[model samples]
Target: MRKIASAFLALLLATLLGTAANPNPGYARVISAGHVEGVLPDGSAYVMDVPTNWNGTVLLYSHGYVPDGASNPARNAPSEAVRTALLDAGYAQIGSAYPETGWVVEGAMPAQLGTLNEFQARFGVARRTIAWGTSMGGMITTGFAERHGRFFDGTIAMCGLEQGSVANWNNALDTLFAIRTLLAPGSTAPLVRLPDQATAIASAAELTAALDVAQTSPQGRARIALAAALRNTPAWTNPAQPEPDANDHDTAQRNQFGALRQFLQTGLTWRQEAEAHASGNMSWNTGVDYARMLANSAIRKQVEAHYRQSGLSLRDDLAALAAAPRITADPAAVAYMIRNISFTGGLTTPMMSIHTTGDPQVPVQTEQAYAEAVTDAGRSRLLRQAYVHRAGHCTFTAGEMLAAVRTLEHRISTGQWPDTGPLTLNRLAEEWDPAATHDYVTYSPGPYPRPFHLHR
Candidate 1:
């Protein structure tokens, strides 16, 4: 699946909305509802929604990844419902289309910064500015809070990959490598630095077919469960539906297969992102210990239960994985990724991050990794994380989003974090709009399987 944000009606609206370039090397369009949208000469687009009741505060949003072939641009907000709510709450909203997409944080960093500067220049400086993002945008927003802390009063990130690109890509590499080695055995599927989209798709098809067959029997299910467990892939995969019952063996296998399918579908594409930036493969598993990793996984109990149900020995599969050859990274490419897009956990502003507990795209463990980093840096007081029990990536409702914004705003203004307990946050989310399905469950994320080390 392409990792772009929920396509805004803005794309369709942009066609109908007329825009003109000004003396500042940028263009602006005034649309219905008194909203102003624009595009910069650098192929970056932006939108600013200022309601009649201006509150002198601006929420600048960073969006998630846009795949290589994406023709349309990302919007300021995920949904009009979110935009309406933000504007109605007396907050101005702004965002950039970004010069390019697909894990291009190098471009995004400056693009977002320039958008804020452009907004300030167009309309006088705001009394307060809050940075916000979703998914990859969440990573960008977190990076913004860390690097440009002085410019924003607060930050909000949702369903973000805070674990940093290196760790995030490497974690996916673990699952893909395991699936190929354990499930397909000797079949040739591209594992790293895919040459092209066709090759990547073919490789994914082979792995996905193997997974489908594996889901049919208890023995195969057990082995498949072991594969997903090695990387802490969640069994929850669908956001449109409720979570599967933990005790149902069939449901467990089915849910886990959903995660594996997601990897096969989009996980292989990481090679493209890394290659784009690093100019070569930067993922590696040379020192990985499959046995130790399984023992340490958050889903260990689930794997054990499935193995018992299968009446098969899990040790055999694990041994095979341990004996299999490992992948290595190009030292130069690794350095490029780290230098270009990684975070240092050096937060100097109040930041709030939210994620779905069972997100398959960007796992909740990313949050854990980031939280630990900030804590280690003695910046724990400036960070807060919340998890919703949902399954898909960036599946937040407008209400849940607004609740998070308010929570961060309170912290930024009061010099202290508010009651952000799951109960309180859920109640606040529920109060936003009953029509929006908000799944805020009390979930504590496990440690990330491969957290990015701040030091070399």
Candidate 2:
């Protein structure tokens, strides 16, 4: 009898290991295809894609904002990369270009999921679906999950803005104000020396006028110069690295500035489109407007008031900049800083969020805030978080990301929670000393009081 019991236990262990090693099949042979259009409730068109294989698990991907609506529907290279990874792990993926290529989460979510539902119905498969996005896409996914939790089995929000209403608006306002402050009258003088006071004033005037023109211009040249100046100048107390020219600029603009512009442009366009539709312009889907309105009541008023206070005069700045033979604006290259941190608690689905500790664009603190919010709301059991030690924006190694994906897949498939051990800061010695027992602190300008590094 004892031998029989031991044999049974050994068999159980082998089965468990086998299940972990070969949990899902048909994950191979995943193909990336594109340009599929999904219809919203209003019959207008939106675009999305499907990772081939119909794995009974669908991911409704929300993309980060893009300046042009046409760009939103454009297949994201990263999304394609992730799709191949998911296919290898045995999952289907789908994503949408938000309405008009703006941050119209309300409209876009329905259109995307509706399309997925249609696909499922057409395929006759009863599969679980997930929602995921990065940055602005993350924010929208959080909102959708909060309202329509029943539709999804889980949500993976990366660097998502979870706070809503005043917090969200204020965060945006603060970032805009930071950019405005960086360009204020005395801001650029230290970066470039002028022959005289008149030259200094002329430069400031030029910059201010150029900004105004860029604001209304379809292309974003003046805005790009402003970004370059902000990057180059160390006028502010907490100075960010200046924009690099060509080679070094890859990480700065490609990742940081590029993401910022996409978010701001997409978000702004989405808000405007939503407002237009709300005020009886129903020809296009106004679902985004409804969500934006619900998110914050005073967004427009606050932005306008701040814009007036900046006194940067976009039109005047643009004219001044144009007059400068050497200076040119690149509207496509404007950098946006993330702000207006907000979150929605009481999530119904299990969530696993991860962010790098050394991320420059979205601070690690943002991730902590989200995790804390989830815990405070009494949903800690339903959430998990992991922190990587890498730098830049969401720049985890492919192997690290693959491990995360596998863990997530296992949880979704078997209802078994994967272990996310204690979070550790990468390159600990560079940032902290476990044995030294020392204290360190870093500071930023006013309104940004959080210590950046306390142990380095």
Candidate 3:
């Protein structure tokens, strides 16, 4: 009897490990995977992984922007572990490393469709498809849902700049413009593109030096805080470090300044690219009311605190901003942006968006802006937005990602939104992957001061 029991136990262990090593017969298995040329000039390349058991569902992934000179193929997955889990669960995954990457959504949308067509030709048509993306990719995903909503059953946009690149770039311009006008008034640094890359790089270096010097003074710190407030820059920037206590004013300022410093390093390059895309300047701040903007800022109290700490007059700073020469967008360029990139919140399918509360690159306020737009369009019922307490762009864990997917799936399958409160999300995340660093927090997003309003 003992010998028979030992043999049975050994057989059971082998069966479990075998299933773990290879997907079960009725589960995920890579049906086909290889690069297929896209329609764009540079030719989009894609990888499609599907399971043999094949749940009828498919996920089309869109990756974030690859800077002008960066490598084109950014082969990405939500998370490696999540990718494997998804595949094992019979979810087919497809992603295309777009031909050329700096804000190329016009070409990306078509490339994605072409890849889908390819998938259908090689494998079979997916009964259900969901679109998902991160950062600029999120913007692309939102655009896809808006334009091609019928093609997808659901969508997930993560830390996306759904307000359109125009509003996004303009908001960043407002912050840097304020910093330059307030802190380095004498420096004639160019905010838009200069004659060449060398000039742009040099300007970036000079701005960095100015910011370094300014960081040492209370008056400079006060001005930096005001600029950060104007742009709604978060008071937290690092995800690896412990989040500052709500009352820690000094740490808050440090975080804000760190974001400002990061923007300074990339501002020139961003402007140069924006110029190329719009055919000229597309960001404008000309009739903006500085005092009103400050009043509306989510971090007004922080600005006030920093001003008080610096013994500086807030009124003077506001006046300086109001009196400073404001930048204006070229009409043609503005029109280009309007048509090429923007979301009307006309969601025809269920959509879920997740954002980090302290993402310096893409502020949480974007969630509010999108929600407002969706509500205005009377499509709020089809949309849900969730927040994470983390302090970095696209910093969600595999567990968080999985929980969000499950939530969206529940909505799609049942036509009823699941409980997505912080506690609920945290619980789901822990249940999905207990070892993951789940950073769910109860966060009420503030209104985005500037959004693409021309469309509405």
* Candidate topping lDDT: 1
Structural similarity to truth (TM-score) of each candidate: 0.90, 0.52, 0.89
lDDT string for model 1 (1-456, tens) is 011122432332242223223245356777856476776655577777778898988889998888777864647786789888878878888898776656677667666766676677667688889999998899889887888787889999899989887887788889888888878899878788787777788888889999888888888788888878867877677876767777665666677788788778877665676576788887899888878878778788898998888898888888888888888998888887786667778898999999988777787788888988888788989998887877788888888888898899899789999998888887788777677667666777877887886843
Model 3 segments beyond 4 Å from truth?
Answer: 1-42, 74-76, 193-195
Q: Which segments of candidate 2 are over 4 A away from where they belong?
A: 1-54, 68-70, 74-77, 164-166, 178-342, 358-360, 397-399, 413-416, 422-456
Candidate 2's residue-wise lDDT over 254-301, tens digit each? Answer: 344443443343323443433232321111111122223212321223
Q: After TM-score superposition, what is the CA distance of residue 102 in candidate 1 from its true location, in Å?
A: 1.8
For residues 185-214, could you state the per-residue lDDT of candidate 3 as single tens digits? 877888864555677777778877877788
Cα-based lDDT at residue 121, candidate 2 = 43
On TM-score, who's better, 1 or 2? 1
Question: Candidate 1, clashing residue pairs?
Answer: none
Model 2, TM vs. native: 0.52
Model 1 has an lDDT value of 0.79
Best by TM-score: 1
Better by lDDT, candidate 3 or 1 = 1
